[model samples]
Target: MSVLPLVFTSGWASGINAYAVVLLLGVFGATGLSDDVPEVLQRPDVLIAAAVLFLCEAVADKIPYVDSVWDSVHTVIRPIAGAVVAALLAGQSGSLPELAAGAVGGTTALMSHFVKAGTRMAVNTSPEPFSNIAVSTAEDLGVAAIIIFALFHPVAAAVIAGTLLALGLAAVVFLAQRIRRFWRRRAQRRAERRPTGPGVRHPVPTDGSEHF
Candidate 1:
């Protein structure tokens, strides 16, 4: 069948939307492991696996506060997703490879989640309706793309998926620091810019006593 669904699923799993797939693939292929797993490149089973992961991810994202809460659970889903993907990719390759793949996939997913979660936190600080709309639209587009790509190209899809995860983690690290620095600088500047308190009227020099 089509591998597009596989690609889409992997992409979303890494916090990307289908509309942005081309850009993601370009960046991921250029800087990350865009071809480490070949099964997604040509296997139906692998493709389906990616689809399953994407589906599970979508469901996980919908439970109201569950999305952010999931982040706190940590140590739970990351390895599971990785293990599952690795196993799917491994096929007959054996358990060791499967375990390794799982580890990679899970970790990749976690990194993506971290970055996205951080972004959402930042967004929530902004005006209401707009933030909700933005987050909802983003999630919708992302889910749609994953479903589309996974059904088409499993292996290549997973490769791109992995790349997204890696890139997301990198982004979180890079941006978190930059944001912190920006705020600190802004605070410092604001403090400096603030006007000083009103000056007290001085008594005549000869008086000395009274208020100084």
Candidate 2:
């Protein structure tokens, strides 16, 4: 089977939650559920590491500003992970060059990562944290579901992933100005609420009688 579908699907998922994608793929491959997954990923140590990181991400991703921080830290990590996974998938399938697959995965992951990070930054402008948590949870679940779908129906999963990515990017571009305005207003409000420092004040003359 061609690995292009899994490459795109996994790359997209990795951007949102690389650890979850790794753990899901590793578990499925280890359990004889999927043969397309690489042997290295199915190793117990790899699965354990991915699981631990995923748990940490799950917690960090739910917090408002913290999720943004986490995303910032993973800006490089996710793309690299995506590339590695894509290379491994290609190796397993023997249908594509590892270099080309890696390039596709890395680029796809970078685009999706930007989308996720930008959306989260905009979400962080809001005072409420529920939206952050909800979005994070949805992303995790979406990654898991997509990986499973890719295992069974790679072409359809890839198409869906591509559609979602396009929509996400379009939405981000459409809301960029609004997001900027929202943060600007929030900052302005914060500045207005800030306490003023003590300072000497000159008294105004009344009836032109107090000029000094």
Candidate 3:
């Protein structure tokens, strides 16, 4: 059904940018663009709140370590948001059961969230700053496009979102080994750089003046 496709699409986008998806949906409903969206999402206060959070995410998502922390914090939030949104849509549409929609939305959101978080971990392994910004920018754009397009063509939007989700998951799996190695090397480097306390001792120095 159209409701199912819309929920699946939104669920995928929610994993990457839940606030953005919520804000956009609220705006669409408030503007009378889509009757399928629930009034609860279109309230003035809800739109304001979603917009504020979306702005916060837009900024925090561009920084490397900050983005990872953001992702970690949203691991639970995103999936719940997806489920609530799906349930509301289903309740309004009367095409699908609320519980079924919630399950589909929440499960898809969880899977896509892991894919996103894992991909970020792998990307952060790179020393460059631009990659994080680029990835975050792309995700925001993708979420907005999918949500807007889903308003008119839910099934097509779902197909695109599903494809992207699958690609992201595959990329995460492929980079799992690299992600592990990067963390291990980083830990070793930190230990090597750690300051020696008054009671600590070291092996032969690297300086020629202090030979083995």
Top TM-score hit: 3
lDDT of 1 by residue, 1-212 (tens): 32323422442464332223323333333444454234343355544454565555455554434444544454355445434543454543343455555555455555565677765444433434455455656765754455345434565656666666567667767677554653565478677887666784533667566564
> Given candidate 2, what's the lDDT at residue 188?
91
Q: Show where candidate 3 strays beyond 4 Å.
A: 185-196, 199-212
Best by lDDT: 2
Provide the global lDDT of candidate 3 against the true structure.
Answer: 0.90
Q: Order of all candidates by TM-score, from best down to worst?
A: 3, 2, 1
RMSD of each: 13.5, 6.7, 5.5
Per-residue alpha-carbon lDDT of candidate 3 for residues 84-168, written as tens digits (9 for 90 to 100)? 9999989999999999999999989999999988888888888898999999998899899999999999999999999999998
> Would you estimate the TM-scores of all the predictions?
0.46, 0.86, 0.88
Query: How much is the lDDT of residue 182 in candidate 2?
Result: 55
Candidate closer to the true structure by lDDT (higher is better), 1 or 2: 2
Give me the displacement of residue 100 in model 2, in angstroms: 0.4
User: Alpha carbon lDDT of residue 179, candidate 1?
Assistant: 45
The reply for model 2, stretches above 4 Å from the true place, is 181-212
Across 1-212, the per-residue lDDT of candidate 2 in tens digits comes to: 78999999999999989999899999999999998989999999999999999999999999987887799899999999999999999998999999999999988898899889888877887789999999998988888899999999999999999998999899889779756865686589787887766784545777879857
Off by over 4 Å in 1: 1-67, 92-96, 154-163, 174-212
